[model samples]
Target chain A: MDSTYINEIRRQFPILNQQVYGKPLVYLDNAATTQKPLCVIDRERDYYLHENCNIHRGVHYLSQMATEAYENARRTVAAFIHAAAPHDIVFTRGTTESLNLLASSLGQLLIEENDKVLISAMEHHSNLVPWQQMLRQKKGQLLVCPMDDNGVLDLQRYETLLDEKPRIVSIAHISNTLGTINPIKEMIGMAHKHGIPVIVDGAQSIAHHYIDVQSLDCDFFVFSGHKMYAPMGIGGLYGKSDWLEKMPPYQFGGEMVDQVSFEATTFNKLPFKFEAGTPNVGAALGLESAVRFIESLDRNQIEAYESALLQRAVEQLSEIEGLRFIGQAAKRSGLVSFVIDGIHPYDLGTIIDKMGVAVRTGHHCAEPVMTRFGIPGTVRASFALYNTMEEVDVFVKAVKKAAAMLR
Target chain B: MTIKEIQDAIVEDFSMFDDWMDRYAMLIEIGKECPLIDDKYRDDKHLINGCQSRVWLSAEMKDGKVYFAADSDAVITKGIIYLLIKVFSGQTPSDILDSDLGFLDKIGLKEHLSPTRSNGLLSMLKQMMLYAEAFKLQEDKK
Candidate 1:
C-alpha cells in the first residue's frame, strides 16, 4: 500500500495519533485487542443516541428501527464470512462465549461418556478450557493434536487423531501466540472424512484473512469483534443450520423462547435460541460498521502489507543478540513472539512499554504453547492494517533499548 | 530504623534516578540483593496469585517481630519485593499491619501496583499484611 492510502487508513483510528510517555505511541498488541476506527465508534454512538431500544419484542417505531438494524448487523456478519444465511450467524459476547455456547450445547447434544473431542496444542484458553470442562463433566476424553517445535501443526498426526473418530474437532484458524495459520480447509476435509464435524476458532484469523465458511465447509466458525477493530462484547458464531437445529439452547430467557408455559416452553429457532439475554444492540451495530470499513478497503493489499510488517519485525528484532523467536512456523500471520536469552519477557515488556511501545508479554493465553517451547513466556508484537513500517522501526528500537538495559 | 524511616530512605534512594530506565536499573540491582525464600517454601503453596509472573512469599514471627522472605522469577518484581521486605521485615506485627506503603507511588513505581499491571506487587503487599494480621492474632491469644 502507498503512504497516502496507509495514512488514510491510520486516520480512521484516532487512538493512533496520541503520544504515550512523552514519545509517539507504537501499538503492537493487536492480537490482544485492536483499537477501534472512527466509523465503528460513530456507528455505536449513533445507535445509542438515536435508535437505542429493546429489540425483537416491541411493535413501536423505535424498537422496529432497532430490531431492523440489529438484524441487518447479523446479515452483515453473515455476508462478511459468506455464511449461507443471516440466521446462520449467532450474536455472542465474543469468541469465548461462542465457543462456550458450542461446547455446552454440542456437548449436551452429542457428547456421551467416553466420547472424544479433538483440539490442537495451539488453541487459546477460550477454545481449550470449555471443551476440557465439558469432557470432564461427561467423563469423556479430550485428545490433543501436537505440533512441531516450530509451532507448525502436524497434519499427518492430526489425520491420525481423526482416525480415532472424535465426536468433534475444534482448531484455531491462526494461533494467537505463534501466528501459525492452520490449513483448516484440508483439516476440515480430513475430519469430515472421519464423519466428525469441525469448529474453526477464527478469533485470530478473522480480521487478518478472508473467511468463507461455505468454501471451508466447516460446521461452525467463531470470532470476536474486538480483535477486528469493532467494539468488544459483540462477536459472531456461524453454525450450519443442520447442527444448530439439533443442539439445545445455550441460554434461556427473553428472546430465545418461542412460548413460555408452566408445563413446557418451546425455544426460538436458529440464532435467537443461542442469544438469550437482551442483546448488545449498539455493539452489534459497531460490529457491522467494522465490517463495512473492512469491505471499503482493498483487503488483499492490507493483508499483504501486514505480512510485510510482520516480516520486517522479525528481520529487525532478529538482529538483537540472544533474541530467539519462539514460533518459527512456515506459514505465519500478523505477529511474532520471541524472547531474549538472559532477559525475562516481563522485564523486557515493562521496559519497552516505558518507551511508548505496547507489546504483549506473557503466555498470550496459550500456556501449552509456552510449555512446548520450554519457556515461561514470550514478548509478542502483533500487527494490524493501520500499523505502519515506521511503527515497526520504533518498536524494534524500543526492544533494543530495553534488551540493553535488561541484559 | 522504623518502617516509616526505611520507606523514606527507599524514596531517597530512588530520588537519584532521573528517568524510568535509571529507576528500573536500580531496581534490578536491588533485585540481586532480595532475601530469597528458601527453595522448600518456593513451591505453589507460597505462590502469589493475580501476578503475570510467579512470586513466592513466606513469613514467620520470631522474637516478637515478623520477618518475610520472598522470591520471584522476574527481576523487577523481585526488586519491588525487596523494597517491601526492607520496610516490613523485623518489625512488630502491629506496626507491619498498620504501615501504609504509599511510598511505592512516591518512587514513581505506582503503575506496578495497579491491579491491571498484574505484577503481583499489590497481591504481595496484601499477603504481607495477612501474615501480620495472623501473627497479631496469635500474639493476642498468647
Candidate 2:
C-alpha cells in the first residue's frame, strides 16, 4: 500500500539489480518461478551452516532443533494459507509432486471402476495428467469441464457433470497460462452439493492472493514454494483431517513409519506420514522465510499493485497492431498471454530476451489450453510485486519492435 | 564459389549490422529471397519436424550434387533455413558432409535465435546432412 515500502521490498531482491544482454533485467517470468529475496536465500544457507541435522529421530540438540525448525515451516505454510490446523499440512517436493501424492493416495482410497474424475480444460498438465493416470489405473472415466471463449470455466456444464457423480473435482485456483482467477469457491460449493471432494491447485494463485482453506472448504489444496519466492523442491499440501485420517501414506520410509516389522508396518500420524525420508530441511526453512516475507508486506497492497500493473500492461499491449490476448476472463491475476499476427511467439520471446525482458513463451505446460485456442504457444508476461510501470513500458515497446521485425 | 567462401561472405554481410534489430532485419530480407519449396513437397513427408514454425524442406540429388528447397511459416526461421541452404546447396555430398557450418555462431545468429529456433536450425542442418549422406551411399553403390 505504501510506495516507499514497496520500493524497499524491491531492493531486497538482489537478482533484480542486474543487467541481461546489456539491458536492465525486466523479469516477467514470475509465474514459472519467482526470484528469491536475499532473506530467503540467507535463511536456507544459515540452516545448512548451523542447523544441518536430520529431523524427528535423534535425541541430540541439533536434531531436536532441526526437527523443530522443519515442523515450524509446516506451521508457517499452514498459517499462510489459513488452514485450521498445522497437522493438516503435508510437505512434498512442490506442486507437481504434491498433486501426484494426492492423486496416488486419493485415487487408491476413493476411485473405483466407472467412477469419474472431473477437471477443467484450463488445468496445467500437472493437474490433468495424474488424474488421467489414476483413471486409467482404476478403469474410471476422466471428464473435462470445458472453458468458454474467454477462458472462463463453464460452471453450468460443470454442475451438469456433477450429475455423473464424479469422485473428485480437481481444478486450478488461477490458471498459470491465462491468469484466469477461477471461481473455485463457488465450484467447490457446487461439487460439495454432490458430495464430491474438490482439490484446488493453488500453484499459481498462492503467490498473488490470500487463500483460506477452511473457508473454501476444499478437501485438498496444493502449491509449490518456488513459484512464490521460496526455494525449489519444497511445497505443501493441506488436506482436511478426516481425509488425512482415511487416506494411506504416499511413501514408506524411515520417518513415516511408526513401527516396521518384517511383515507389516504402521505409519506415523498426519504430516510425517506423508513426508517420508530425509526431507529438504534447509529449503523448508527457506519456505518459512518466504512466508515471512509475504507477511511483511501488505497483501491487499501487493495484490492491488499487481492487478493494476496487469491492467496497464494489457491496455498498453492492446495498442500494438494485430496483438490478440488469449484470456479475457473477467477476473485475472498477475499475468497476460498474447499472440501477434504473423509473428511466432517463440520469435517474439527470443527478441524480448535479447532486449533483456524475460518472458515465458511456450505451451506453459498447458497444451490443452493452447490446443483449445488453436495456436502453438503464447508470449506470457507474468508480474511480481517487484515489477514497475517503467519495466512494463519497456516490455511493451520491446514486444512491438519484435513483432515489427518478424513481420 | 566454395561452400566455405559462401558461408564466409554471408557471415561478413551479417557483420555490417552492429545492432540485433538490423541483423534480424537482414535475416528477414534473406528469408524473403529464399527459394520456395515445391508445393508437392510441402506435405508432411518432406516437412522438417522439430521447428517451432512449420518448415517444409525438400532435397534433390543430381549428378552427386545436393540441391535443397525449403519454406517456413515464420520469416526468421525461413531466413535461418536460407543461410543453411546457401552454404549446403550446389555442393557435392562430401563437401556438404565435411563442412562444420560454424558460420551461424560467427554471425551471432546462434545466440540471437531462441532455444526452439536453434533446435529447429540444428534439425534443418541434420536433415540436409542426412540427404547428403543418403546421396553419398547411393554413389558408393553405383
Q: Output the number of the TM-score-best candidate.
A: 1
Q: What would the per-residue lDDT of candidate 1 be over residues A285-305, giving only the tens digit for each residue?
A: 999999999999998999999
Question: Where does model 2 sit among the CAPRI classes?
Answer: medium
Q: What would the C-alpha RMSD of candidate 2 be, to one decimal place?
A: 2.0
Interface RMSD of 1: 1.2
DockQ of candidate 1 compared with the true complex: 0.66
Point out where model 2 deviates above 4 Å: A1-3, B33-35, B46-54, B112-119
lDDT of 2 by residue, A206-301 (tens): 988999999999999999999999999999899999999899998889789999889999989887899889999999999999999999888898
Q: Model 1 reproduces what portion of true contacts?
A: 0.48
Clash statistics: count for each candidate: 0, 0
On the 0 to 100 scale, the lDDT of residue B139 in model 1 is: 96
Give the chain B TM-score for each candidate: 0.95, 0.90
